[model samples]
Target: MTNAPSSLTSAEPVTLSEDEAAQLAEELKQQLRQGQRLAGDTQAIERMVAGLGDKRGLLRLTFAESLGTVGSAAVPALCQAMCDHDNVTVRRAAAKTLTLISDKQALPHLLKALLNDDDPVVQGSAVGAMAVIGADAVDGLLNIIVDPNNTPMQTGLASWGLAFVGARAPQALRDAAKSENALIRTAAIAALGDQIQNQGDEEARQLLLGALKDPDEEVRSEATTLMGKLNDSGWAMPLLIPNLQDSSPLVRKNAALALMKLDDPSAIPELESCMSSEQDASLIPIFRLAINQLGQER
Candidate 1:
């Protein structure tokens, strides 16, 4: 007479206590190290996904790493668990495991979780996975940012994903900069700042220059903020100086801040001039600060 195999070998979901989960995690790691593959083992994969809900944080991380090693073969089960699982802990873990896998095919499922998951941590984990997937995730992320139907939190997550992808895939941001929708253009401009700072992308610099004159106030304001944050006063100073007279007070104020970051003494004359002519009471303090700061830098 033979004893029945453990439930882990069965197709049904199995729950493990902390000690059992720790032992299983070690066994899986050993098997992975010995060149054993779990590629088509649906039973084992499902069990691992369920293990993601283990109460021990370290054990949950172990399960996620083990599942990540399973690679694309693990994506389907992980996606289902992330989207449909009853336990929020399992859903969050599944999304994070997909981030380690970083497979493009998981984008759709990750996007679904990011937009529909009631748990903010799960949504955040889903976006984090999309960001790790890199260039392939750009369009979906940008679409979410421009979609008026999505909530502000959703759009904010998408913006963060774009910034993460920007330096690695700058061409996508350049293409997005020409979008007819000002929202898309503004988001694209904001992401491109990362490209400029990281890669010193000349084309990105040019796009920022054109954005400074954009018809949309938001676009101009975003571009101005990028200029201040760039920390390259030589190039940014000339472009930002004219923006001090922009029709929008926000843009004018941002221009002052960017000039201060440039830290160049030559900008003092320009800052003083803008202050003398400035009419907005709220802006007067900003202009005065920029002039004083630039003077001290000399």
Candidate 2:
């Protein structure tokens, strides 16, 4: 057996012979091709975990990737690498691998990386991995969302992350929509729209209706768009007409489109008034479309 210098503990730099390097390269290729089937063999997982300490950057990265494809079975070793590996790059690579593996069992390690890892890329990978875990990740995400010390970007990402948490999302989002911070409120409302679609939840409908009066035009516009697509007959004319006179062109445009969807005759007079007075050159086309749609229904 060829004695290789320790990449993890030795002070000496690793030097690989052409034959030895070729052997390692070939091993990585075979492991990559083998994929998750490798998880079945405890002996093979040990070899792959040991290979993460290889001095060769390419070999270390390749081995980490192959182990990731090896799925949940490889997580314990990968988590050890994230925590105990002497090399920062290798530790980050392990975190990246966990993302590909997408095992929720790795969440504790990833959350540690998100909070304690100095490397931004490593931190980002943790956030991304948690996001991929979806609904199962909500508790960790809520921590990020509510932490006052988190950067705006991180907070925003946490809000965005909540959208993927399935049924557990609405109440948290409804709370976020009431936030004093407009940014959080907007993101919460936007995500809530997709969450509530076709579910016919009256509470969510009311939330959107209330949002239509938000001080922030962007929030109001998004709410208007959601209301229109809701196809809730009661919202047809009353919910949309006032928006035609909104200060923001986007709000008025979305309202017009929503009215078109409602096909309510009460919108006809309002549409005519908006059509004649609307000064935005872009909006005229939309106004004309709504008018044509309403006229056709008559």
Best-performing candidate as measured by TM-score: 1
Backbone collisions counted per model: 0, 0
Give candidate 2's whole-model lDDT: 0.70
* Candidate 1 residue spans exceeding 4 A from truth: 1-14, 32-40
What tens-digit string does per-residue lDDT give for candidate 2 at 236-281? 5787788998999999999999888877766888888987898888
Model 1 per-residue lDDT tens digits across residues 1-298: 1121121122345577777788988888787778886554877887788899988887788788889888888898888888877789999999999999999988888888887888989988999999988888988888898788888898999998888887767888898888898999999999997788878888998988899999999999999989989888787888998999999999999999888888888988888888889889899999888888888887
Question: Which consecutive 10 residues in model 1 have the weakest lDDT in total?
Answer: 1-10
Q: List the residue pairs that clash in candidate 1.
A: none
TM-score of 2: 0.55
Root-mean-square deviation per candidate: 7.0, 8.7
State residue 240's C-alpha deviation in candidate 1, in Å: 0.4
Q: Give TM-scores for every candidate, taking all chains together and pairing residue i with residue i.
A: 0.89, 0.55
- Residue pairs with clashing backbones, model 2: none
Best by lDDT: 1
